[model samples]
Target: MQGKRSNQIVQNTAFLYFRMLLSMGIGLYASRIVLEVLGVEDFGVFNVVGGVVSMLTFLNNSLSSASQRFLTFELGKNNIMELSKVFNISVSIHLAIAGLVVLLAETVGLWFLYHKLSIPPERFDAALWVYHFCVLTAFFGILQAPYIAMIISREEMSLFAYISILETVLRLLIVYLLKVIMFDKLSLYGILTFSVSFFIFLLYWQLCRKRFVETRIKHFIWDRKRYIQILSFSGWVLNGNLAVVGYTQGVNILLNIFFGPAVNAARGIAFQLQNAVNNFSYNFQKAMNPQITKSYASGDMGLMHRLVFVSSKVTFFLTLIPCIPILIETNFFLEKWLGKFPDHTISFVRISVLITIISALSYSMIVSIHSTGTIKKFQLWEANILLMIVPISYFLLKKGGTPEVAYWTTLVLMIIAQSARVVIVSKAIDFKLYTYFNEVILRILLGLPLCLILPYWVFVNMNEGWSRLIILVVVVCISVGLSFYFLVCSKSEQRILNKVGFGFVAKFQALISRYSLNK
Candidate 1:
């Protein structure tokens, strides 16, 4: 059973890695094309409009999380009937919610568009087109929660990886179409791409329903009790979602109000880059969420605890390793790739990286809270802490602080919120945050000096582009090799190394095979 579980984990992790590479890779490449195609103004228009939709999507996002959790838990408990009921109830609720959102977008969202948003009169119609299509896309996208939940529950993560790749390829194809057909109509380009995305999501969901028994909608029946249970769990979840969206998208909106669409475009670039980096680590957590939920349901706290710690450690290192280079080379990267420096994007990336490092450590605790159904109390505390950002951010900006100040303020709020959450969970679970920190955090803290020193040496010693490239390669090799040896590789690591044919047993096996009598 242990070996089987280990294999399952490796398979899941491999799927997540591929998915992250494909999705984030496409995003990074396509962002350059998109900026060139749309130019600054329209690109800003699209992001500003999309940010509004993101705020609304927050309501359904957390609810979808609830759907995934309940589905995984029921499957783990071997309660097929309850799982079916959850499926139907969740779908029914989402359909209702999606309808209401469309109605609100048409009415309230429209009013805010003309009045609250800082759009030039010339761009109004184009922005409206983008907004309408975004609303439609979101409506259709929300209905796939049950199918997505089913896939996660069954641990068919490779399917998700394929879907991410397919979606990205389709979006790139849309970009090509924009070049040929739409020309400079960035609004229409956004609308067309969103329409295409909706169709792709629906197609995947339909395929899952047809292929998997657990996904068949016919097996599901509406149950009021199930509806109540999901909603009750999701209510506190909604508070956290609202708080997060308020601070994140709300900050974008605030930027639009204070500055203009151009500034929002700069903010968009920084956010997309931050999101791309974050998704690299987040994909692992997302893939493990179902397994974590299942383990919690089945009373396997030991495995759950092990997964939690491993996730924290691996996520930290993965995020930290790439971030050093990104931090050091931010201006060079932006200028080289985007043809110009996006305003405030560099500072936003810097402060946001700090926020991500703090938040990544807290994800393990958050997972424990979600799995054990002890998230209710923490939700309120977390939400309150997040809410403090709004007033503090406003006051700082009003006092003439730049975007950098706002970014740091936001980061501090996130750290405080995450720390409060860890404390709450520690009280409930009787496991200190320091337990994981003492083991993993030191590697990150100590290795970071090497991360910085190597990169700084490369940047300083290399003047020419080719020389810089060579120096970067050398520095990366030496830095990572030394860091792994001193910071991460240990006896326990050796045991895993043996399993993967890299340790003493592996060397012994290779020697025996080389000198075997069969030869």
Candidate 2:
């Protein structure tokens, strides 16, 4: 059973990385094109205005979490009947949430965008267009939440990969159109992107209906008891998501007030980089998330514990591989990629990447806590710690702190929050704190410093230019690889790696033999 689960994780990870590489390549190129076309002012306008709408998406994120936990938990127990009911319930809740978000967007978010945000008056109409499409995009995302969760829970990662590729292609297509389209480029990008979103939503809906009976939206399967239970779970999730919205959008708003829209544009670009780097970890997490939930559901604490710790270390390394080099080359990379927008872009990217690494430490723990379905205390305290970033950032900004102070504050606060997450999850599962610290946290600390010494030395010595970047990449890869293999991976993991190595070699030889025979 463990082997089968491992195979499933391998398959999902392989598919996800395939999706990530293709999408990430196109996304990076498209981002450059979009930045050039939109220019700084318009880009910043779109980012800050869109942030208002994003603030209302807290419920969407929360409910997505709520629905996925329930659906995946039901599937783990092999309760298809309950799964279908959960699907219906999730749909009803999401649609209602979508409506609520729309209402909030139209009234509160709209007012905040126009009156509160530091937007220039001339581009107001363009901002309005962007806001309309952003709300449309939000609704599509809300409605499609369950299908995405359903696909992942079913472990149909390849299918998800195909859909992701389609989305990526559409995004690339939008970038192409931005150059050719005669209308207002900003508004056109907004409307066309939302059109793509609408198309993707319909595609997911059709796919889910055909593939899963649970998604069919049959006769009213409403149960007040179950509804209350889901609400009870999702309510705390709402608080947590609100915290995310508060720190993210709230900080954006504060920055707009303090620094203006150009700074927001820089932050937007930084977030794009953040997404690209974090994908390496999150995609891996997505593959293992269901297994964590399913194991806990089946009372397989041993597997759950292993998944938790191993995923923490592995996901951290995944982020580290790309991040350390980027951190070292932030100025060159950002200047090369985005062509100098504002003051804080490089600092933002560096700190954001570093924060992503810190956040990776707690990703699996968040999954473990959520899987246990006992997230009230966890989410409450975590949210409190997380939400404090906004006020702390605000206080600093008001005191004339640099924009880097915002992210520095975020990193420090998140480390605290993430530590809290580990504590909560460990206690929830009654996992050994000493074992986690020794096997996961200490192992990573031991490996990383030793690993960085050689890489950082090489980076410091290398002359400027492509040679330096190439050498940095090689040094980072080799140092991290050897350090992780020797110090981080468990004996079981070492065995697994060796088996996989030999298995691949054997398969390659057999394929060569068969080809020769055919010849």
Candidate 3:
């Protein structure tokens, strides 16, 4: 059973990584085209305005998290009937949340877009178009969440990957249309973007209805007891999700107020790159998260602890690989990719990459805590720590700090927040803090210097070009691989790696020999 579970994880990770590669390639290219088509100011306008809509969707995030946890937890217990009820309840709750969001967005969000953000007089109309479209997009996205959660909890990662690829291709087509279409580009972009969301939502809804019996909502469920239970869990999660929205979208608004639309363009580009790179860790975590939750639900505390430890270390290493080259060669990559990026884009990308590496370490801990369903103290303290970024960033920008100061503040607060999670998770799960430190943190510290040394040296010694970038990436891969094998990996893990490595080589040899015989 353990072996089967491990194989499932490996297979799912492979599917997700394939999805990530194609999606990342198309996404990076699509972003370049969008920037070229929109230009910096209009791009910034869309980013900040769209950010307002995102801020209002925090409830959706909260509910989505709760739904995933409960669905997966029920599956762990082999409770099929309860799973169906949970799915129905989740769908009903999301519909209500969707209506609430629309109300809030049209009222509070629209007002903020008009009065609070720093848009030019002429572009305000376009920004307003973007705002309304964004709200519509968020509406569909909210409705889509329960289906997505159902798919994930079912471990239908292949379907998830295929749907994701389809969405990316559709978005890429939108970029192409933006380039050729002669309509008001910004407004047209907004309309097309919402169209994509609505279409994707339909796809998920239909797929889930066909694929899973639980997702066929025969009628809306209003189980008052279950409603309170799910809402009570989501209420605490709402605090953490709000803090996330505050630091991310809230800080975007602050940037608009302080530095205007051009700076927002820079920050937006940075995040596009960050999101692409973040998939390296996120895909891995997605594959592991269900297992973590299910294990806890099944009372397999040992397996749950092992998954958390392995996932935490592995996510950090996965994140660090791309980050090293990107940090060292941000200018080269950005210049090559964007051709004419806005001011502060390079600095923002570099700092955001560092922030991603730090944040990667906490994904496992977050999932583990959620799995236990005792997140009130965890969420409360974590929210307090993360929520500090907005006010501190506001004070700094008010005192004339540079645009990058917001990102820097985020980086620092992220570190503090991750430390807080370690402590909270320790208490919540009776996780051994010292064991985590010795196994995960200490090994990371030891292995990181080795991973950086070769990449930085190659980067400094060589001239900047495709050749240099290729060499730097190769050197970093080799460095990180060796360091992880020699230092970071446990003896048992090393043996497993050896087995996989040798097995691959043997398969390659056999394939080559068969090809030679055929020739």
Best by lDDT: 3
Q: lDDT scores for all predictions?
A: 0.77, 0.88, 0.91
TM-score: model 3 vs. ground truth: 0.97
lDDT of 3 by residue, 1-519 (tens): 765676678778888999999999999898888999998999999998889889999999999999999999999999999999999999999999999999999998877777788999998888888889999999999999999999899999999999999999999999989988898889999999999999999999999999999898888877899999999999999999988997788988898898889999999999888988899778989999999999999898988988898899889988988899899988889888889999999899999999999999989989999999999999998899999999999999999999889999999989999999999998887878999999899999999899998888887789989999999989988998899889999998777667656655776799999999999
List where candidate 1 sits over 4 angstroms from the true fold: 464-490, 497-519
Show where candidate 2 strays beyond 4 Å: 504-519
**Tens-digit per-residue lDDT, 15-129, candidate 1:** 8788788877778778878888888888888999988887777768878878888888998899997877787788888888889888888888888988899988988888888
RMSD of 1: 3.8
In candidate 1 the C-alpha lDDT for residue 119 amounts to: 89
Cα-based lDDT at residue 177, candidate 2: 91
Collision count for each candidate, in order: 0, 0, 0
Tell me which of candidates 2 and 3 scores higher on lDDT. Answer: 3
| lDDT (10s digit) by residue, model 2, range 130-152 | 99999999999899998999999
Q: What TM-score does structure 1 among the candidates reach?
A: 0.92
